[model samples]
Target: MTAKPLIGITTYLTRARWGAWDLKAALLPASYPAQVQRAGGLAVMLPPDEPGAAEAVVSRLDGLVLGGGEDLDPALYGQAPHARAGAPVPERDRWETALLSAALERGVPVLGICRGMQVMNVQAGGTLCQHVPDLVGHDGHNPAPGTFTDHAVEPVPGTLTGKLLPDAFGVATHHHQSVDRLGEGLVASAYAEDGTVEALERPGGGFVLGVQWHPEAREDLRLTEALVRAAVEGPF
Candidate 1:
């Protein structure tokens, strides 16, 4: 049988509770691995590691998924912390940033979601709006704590996101930060009705795409499938 592409997904190192045990754990939503499997890939959970470890990790993976989590430290992109911003996970920030750098160097396909999207932007020397509601004038992008809201995003006609989801499509969103300055070599590929950037991509990069929504949270596998397909097909 043909081997399935190995896809590595970043996870949260947090204090999680399960069956009367509350301890530090490396965790990811079950939806992520399930979605990867459904998309015909082997899913592997990648927790935060030492500074330079990402190079070795990326070298073996066919693709990478920067999964969603806490807000990035504003200092990463040269800004003060906003009152509305969540506390930063320094280790995760450092590890993931290194992972992104190595992945880019190796030409590995990447799919970044929610906080993942913000990480990509910040890694590319771009800035985030911190509190998106402050700019969009509403909390629709993040309607509640730990709950997702539905919103439509219009993908640019000729971009990767647009080609996969050609029209306005509803997505599960729960984020307070949005991309402000476009990242180096990154272009906005989709936006919400409020003009908030919903997706970004590097046109010349091999399958590097970031969406400010949670595709794994729902049954829609189009986005995840696209990543797996890119991994299976190798670099463009």
Candidate 2:
């Protein structure tokens, strides 16, 4: 029997104070691993590290999933922090950037979610809003982070995402920051009525899709299935 495809998920660093030492440990939510397993892939949590570490992780993985969390460091996009930049986690930002770059170059199927969406964009020479609420003058995106809210988005007439979710409109959202400037070679496949890019994809590349939503957090399994299919089928 063929072995299951190995899917690597980028992990976050957590500071746990124990004894006299502040433990810097790798952490990720359980949903990601559970999602991968449900989709028939063996999930591996890849911790953020140096650039070299990113290459090492990519080499052993059949596919990559960029999980959601935190905000990207402003320095990555040649900008100063906005008033709402929050606490910058440079290490996680750096590692995720390297992972995205390496995965694209290696043609590994990649599925990015929420903050993962922003990481892919920044890695590809794009920029973000940093804090959408300040710029947009509203906070509709994150009405309540954990609650399921529906937002209307129009998908591009012809694209991978369009093919997956083809209709007049679609729903799902929970983000404060979003793509402000698109990355080179990426096409905005979907957009919210407020003009935030909700989904993105590379025209003729492998399964390189990013969604500004937590599909794993939802009860639907189709999103996870699509990613696993792409990985196992060796990216279209």
Candidate 3:
């Protein structure tokens, strides 16, 4: 029997306590693994590590899934902290950014989710708003923290996400920040009613797409299936 495609899902290494001198550790959402497996790919947890760690993991995996998590350390892009910068996890940022670069170079199919989506943007020379409400001059996309709310996103017709998801869909959101400045190679493919960049992709890359929503958290597996299919069958 043929082995399932080895898909690497990036993780966030975080310290449980939000204090100085506390030991940091790795933490990945369980939904990611379940979703990937449900979509027919073998999911492997790839923890954030040194510069070379990404390349090592990419070499073994046919696909990459950048998982969701905390706000990134703004210093990665030479920026000062915003009021909503929260706790800076330099180690995690360094690890995932390096891994993302490596995965891109290796031409691995990539699906970035939430913080993963933001990392993809930063890796391609982009910046974030830190907090959408503060920058957008409003509060709707992210209403309450740690809760799921639906937001409207208009998808670009004929794009991967468009073909996979509904033409105009309500996606679950729980992010404080949103994509402010776009990156080098990505094209903003979808947007919220308030004009937040809800989805992005690189046509030049094999299958590089990022969405600022939690698709795995939902039971409907179409999104995950489409991603896995794209990786296994190549972007069409």
lDDT of 1: 0.93
Give the number of the best model, judged by lDDT.
1
Q: Report the candidate with higher lDDT, 1 versus 2.
A: 1
Which lDDT values do the candidates have, in the order given? 0.93, 0.84, 0.83
Ranking by TM-score: 1, 3, 2
Worst 10-residue lDDT window, candidate 2: 165-174
Candidate 1's C-alpha runs over 4 A off are none
Clashing pairs in 2: none
Candidate 3, residue 10: lDDT: 81
- Expressed as tens digits, the lDDT of each residue in 79-145 for candidate 3 is 8998767898777788888878887888878888989999999989898988888767776766887
Between candidates 2 and 3, name the one with more favorable lDDT.
2
Q: Which ten residues in a row have the lowest lDDT in candidate 3?
A: 14-23
Clash total of candidate 1: 0
